[model samples]
Target: MNEIGGWRLSKKLGSGGNGIVRLAQKGEQKGAMKILRYDSPKARNRFHDEVMSMRLCADIPGVLPVLESQVDPDEPGQKWFVMGLVKLLTDQLSDRSGLRTVVQAFAAYAETLAAMHQLKVSHRDIKPDNLFFYDGGWAVGDFGLATFQGKKAVTGGGRKIGPIYYLAPEMLNDPGNADERCADVFSLAKSLWVIATGQHYPLPGSYDLDHSAFRIGSYLSGERGVIELDRLIASATAFEPSRRPSMKLVGEELRAWLAPNVEISMPTNIDFKEHIAAIEQWQHSRARAAKSQKVRDEAIRSLTNRLSDYLNSPLSNLKNLIEKSLGITTTINKNPKCGFLELRVEVPADQDRLAFIILILDLNCESFPAVNLQGRIILEWRNKAGFINLIWKRCYEFIENGADEPIKIDTLRAEMTEATLKALSETLSLIIPSHKIEHKPKLVRIKVHDEKGDMLSGVSLRFIDSEGITLAAAKTANGIVEVALPTLKNVVIFVAHGSFNSTVVTLPDENLLVVLNGDPRSRSMICGGSWVSLAGLKGELAFVHDEIEGGIHRLYVHLKELSGNSGAPGAVDLSIGKPVRLKDNAGRVAYMTPRAVIGDNYLIDFEHAGDL
Candidate 1:
C-alpha cells in the first residue's frame, strides 16, 4: 500500500469524471479519496472547486463531506481530497426491493437536495451510483458536474456534462445556459424513480408500461394515502423547466408520506439493505434516449411467482379486507404470464333465487393509459331463472383525477365497498317472482378502423338503446370486438375513445370505419341556427398573440383579418388578446379558446381569465 498525505491507499473503488476513487485507511480510519488525474492548471483549479463545494455542504446530513485535501497546486504532484466512506445505495437495494426501503432513501435524498437548492448548489449528475446509504441515512455524492452561484462556466461546445440517463433535456440541448436548480429537480426525480423501480430508466411522461401489479404505487396502495408519485415524477421530469415543482415542495410532499397514518408496512422479511454488495463502476455518459423496447421484453412476471409472497403485499391485504367485510369469498383465477388484472367476484344470493351480483375489474394492456384504469361498478344480470343479479359497478376510473395516478388502495377499496352495497340494494328493488328462461347469448363481431382505413384497436365501443340506455359495452381488440345486441328493442352502436368524439353507427353496420373526414363540428355549428358569425369575412384568418399593455390579460387572443394568409399586407385588426364569448341569445352558451393554430401563426393558448 502506498501512503499519500499520511493515508495508505488500499483497493481501487471506482473512477469519477475528475479522477480515480480509492479506499484510503489512516490509523484505523477509512475513507474515499479522489485523486486528480491531469496536472494542468485548469484541472487543478477545477478539482479545488469540487473540494470547496463539498466543504460548503460539510455538516448537511445527506451530503458526503470533504475531510482533508491537498489544495495547494504549486507543491502537489496530484490534487486529492478525502471524503467519508459510504456504501452505495444500489448495493443496499435492488430490482426486487420493497417500496418502504425506497421511501426511506427518498426522504433523505429530498431533504438533502432541498438544502442544496437553498444554498444554490446543484448536484446535476444524479444516478444510482452516486447515491450512498451511510450514517443512518442516504447521501448524494459526486459533485463533478455541480454548479453553484457565481461559478465560472467552462462548458465545451457540443458536449453534455451531466449523467446521460438522468440529465434533463434542457441540459443536453444547452448545458451552459440551462438552469442548474431545475436540472437538479429533474435528475433527482429521475434518480428516485430508478431507485424505487429497479428499471434502467424512466419512461417518457407518465405512461408507465410496467405491470400495475408490480409498480411502486401498487406495492403501497392498500389502505394508504394517495402518494401520486407517478404524477409527481411526471411533473418534475416535464420537458419544460417552468412546469417542474420547486425542490422545497418536492421535499414537503415526500416527507408527507412518512407520516404515521400513511406508513406502508414492509411486506416481507427480506431486508433489501442486508443484501450483498455489488459495487458497479460508474460511467460518465451513454445514449440520451433509453431503449424502452428492452423494458417491454421484461414485462409482467408470472402469477405463480406471486403464489407465496404476493399474499403479503398491500394489494393482497386489500383483497382480503374486501372479502372479509362483504362476507363473500371471491373466486379469482390468474395466468402468470398475462398482464391483465381481471377479477370476478360472486355475490350473495337473494331469497327464492331472485337476485345475484357479479363484481368485476378488467385491466387489460390495450385499453390502458388512454382511459387509464377503467372498470364497471354496476350491471343488471339477465339470467333465465328470473334471478335478478345486481352488479355493483359503474364506470369508475382510478386515474381520472390525475392521468398518472395509480389505483390507490383506499380509493379502490372505498369505491368497491360502496359499489357492492349499492348493487345489492338495486338487486333487491328489481327482484320479482318470474319464470326461469335461459337462451343462447349473441355476440356481433364488429371491426373498427380509422379515417385512413387502418385498423383501430383499443377503442371503447358502447351499444345503446334509443333512450340512450347502455345495453352492452366492450373494447375492440385487434381492430374487432364482439358485442351482444338486443333481439326485441332497436339499438344503436357508438364508440367513445377516452374524451374524443365517437364514431356512431346503427345496427347492420358491422364493418365500422372511423371516417372523421368532413368537419362535422362546422356542420353542427351551421345547423345550430343561432350562433356568432365573423364580422366582414376576409382572405386570411390569423390568430396571434397580443403583447400590448402587458397583453391586456393573458387569455386575450388578437385576431387579425389579413389580406393574404402567407405574405402579409397590413393586418386588419379584429379582436385584441381578451377572452370573448359569442352569445346566441341563449345566455352562457358558447365560448372560444384557441385549441391549436395552423400555418406560421403566433398563436396564444390560454384558459378562462378576464371574460368579455
Candidate 2:
C-alpha cells in the first residue's frame, strides 16, 4: 500500500506513459487517483490543464466528475487528483450484454462529447478505454490529452495524439496543423462503429489521405444490418474535415437513430434527476399519447408500403416461387379501418371457384393498458373445396416505461409488422392445397425442371378430363411425360412428388415446361394433408386426419397394443403441437386431438415397443 497526500492507495488500477491510476481510499470513501510520474515543468503544466478542464466540464451529462485534487506540500513538485470510481465500458462489454445496452452507451457518450464541444472542449482521446459507466449512464474520463478551442498545442509541434487506429487521416498527414475538433469527430465515429459491430475500423495502416475516403466507403458498402447507422458513419468519417458534421449534429443524428423519442440538447449543465422527471411527465401527458399514436400509425403505413414494394420488386423471390409452385396468381388487398390493418389475399382455384384469406392486424395503442401497447394478428382463411376455415391469433406487447427513452414506439411498430408477416406466411403454407385438376381431354407432352433449370426425374403426374375423371396417371422416369390424345382440347394436369405440387391447363400441342423452386418440405402441414404410422411405442400409434365440429380440420392420434404380454400398466407420453400422456391401463391410448398443430411429425423406431 502507498499513501499520496492524505489518500491511501490500496491497489493499482492502470498505468500509462504519463501517469498511473490507483484505487484510493480516504477513511470510508473510495475513489480513483491518477498521479503524474514525471516531475518536469511541462508535465506540471499539462496536469494543471487537465485539472482545469475537468473542473469546467464536471457538470456535463457524460463528463466524469472530479472528487479531489492534491499537491505534495513536502516535495513541492508531485501532483495527483482523485475522481469518482466507475466501471469501465470494457468491463460492461466483457459481461456480454445485449446490443441494446451497447447502443445506449454510445448514445450517452455522443451526448457527452456534444456537451463538451458546446463548451469549447475537445476530448482528444475519445476511445473505448476512456469511457466508463457511472450511475447507470456512460461518462467520459481520462482528460490527459484534452484541448480547448483556440488554444495552441501543448506538445510544441508535429506530435500526434489519440490511439493510432482511431487518429483521423488529416492528423496523421499533417500533425502540426491538425484540427482537434475534427479529429474528435472522426474518433467518435470510430468508437460508435466499434460499439455497434464488435470490431475495429477496417481501414488501418492506410495513411493515404486522398484515397482514405474511398476505402472507407467501399468497406461500409459491404456491411449489412443497421443500414441507417452505416450511412451516418460514412458521413462522419469523410476524409475532408469540412465535409464532416459538427459534434452536436452527430449527437442529434445518433440519438434519432438509437431512439427517436429521446430529445437531447447541449444545455449549459445537465441535471439527471430533472431530465428523468421531465421524461416521466411527458410520458403520461396527452401530447405524448398523441405522439405515440402517431408513431404507431406511421409504422402501419410504412409496413404497407414495404409489403407493396416487396410484392413488386425483382427480389421478391418468395412471391415468384409461390406463384410458380402453386400455379396460381395471388393478389393482396389492403384495407385500413378503425385503427386496424386488413389484408385480403385472393387465390383463384378454377374458372368458377376462388379462395380468400383475410389477415387482420390491430395496432391500436389506446386499447391496451397505459405505458404499453398490445398488438394482435388474426389470420383466417377459408378453402372453397372443403368449406374449411383455419384461424390463428397471436398477440404481442410493447412497453414504454418512460425510462425506455431513445427507444421509440415506432420500433414496436416494426416488430409488430414483422410478426404479422411471419404469421401470414405460416398460415398461407397450411391452407394451400396440393395439386388438383379439372379440364377437357387432350394429348400433350410436358417436361419438368427444378428452379436451376435442371431436369427433375421421379415426378408424379396426374391428368383429368373436363368431366372430373382421371384419364392417366404416371411417374416420369426422365423428366418427360407423353400421353395419347382423346382429343386436341384443354386438359388439366396435376404434377406432384414428395412435397411438390402444381396445377395447370394447356392445349395438346403447346410446348410446356414447368419449373419448381420453393422447398415444400419447409412449409407447415395443415390438418387434412396426410396420416403417418409410428412403431416401437407401448402400442401401435398412428396419426389420422379428422374434421372437428367448427368445420376445422385437425390431426387425430390413436394408439393400440395387440398380442403383447401383460405387464404393469403405465402411461405413454406423446407431444405434437401439445403434450399428451395416455395411461396404459386398457393396453391402448384412446383417440385424442391436440391443442394446436403445425410443422411435420416424426416417430422413432426401436426394437422393443415398450422402449418409448
- What is every candidate's alpha-carbon RMSD to the true fold? 22.7, 23.8
In the predicted model 2, the residue pairs found to clash are 259-406, 439-465, 439-466
Top TM-score model = 1
Residue 310, model 1: lDDT of 34
| Candidate 1 worst ten-residue window by lDDT | 276-285
lDDT tens digits, residue span 467-554, model 1? 3355776877877787666531334454544212333443333344543222212111100112223322322233332323421212
Question: How do the residues 1-612 of candidate 2 rate in per-residue lDDT, one tens digit apiece?
Answer: 388768999878998767889999999988999898888777776777777788879889878888899643235846899988999887867545754576678778878888886676878888878889987778999888888643322765666677787878877656556667778888877777676566655355322222323222223322222434444565567777755656765665556555534456865675564344234333333322353666656644654454334333321443455567655554433445422344444554444444444444444333221122223333322222222222333343322222221243445445545654565454444344243333445456888887778787877665544333456666676788777656543244555544342323322344578765433221111122343332222444455434346434444444454222232323233322222434343343222223222222221211211112
Give the runs in model 2 whose Cα sits over 4 Å from its true position. Answer: 71-75, 94-96, 149-153, 200-202, 205-225, 260-612
lDDT of 1: 0.52
Q: TM per model?
A: 0.43, 0.40
Summed backbone clashes in each candidate are 11, 3
Misplaced by over 4 Å in model 1 are 94-97, 150-153, 204-227, 262-612
Task: Report the CA-based lDDT of candidate 2 relative to the real structure.
Answer: 0.54
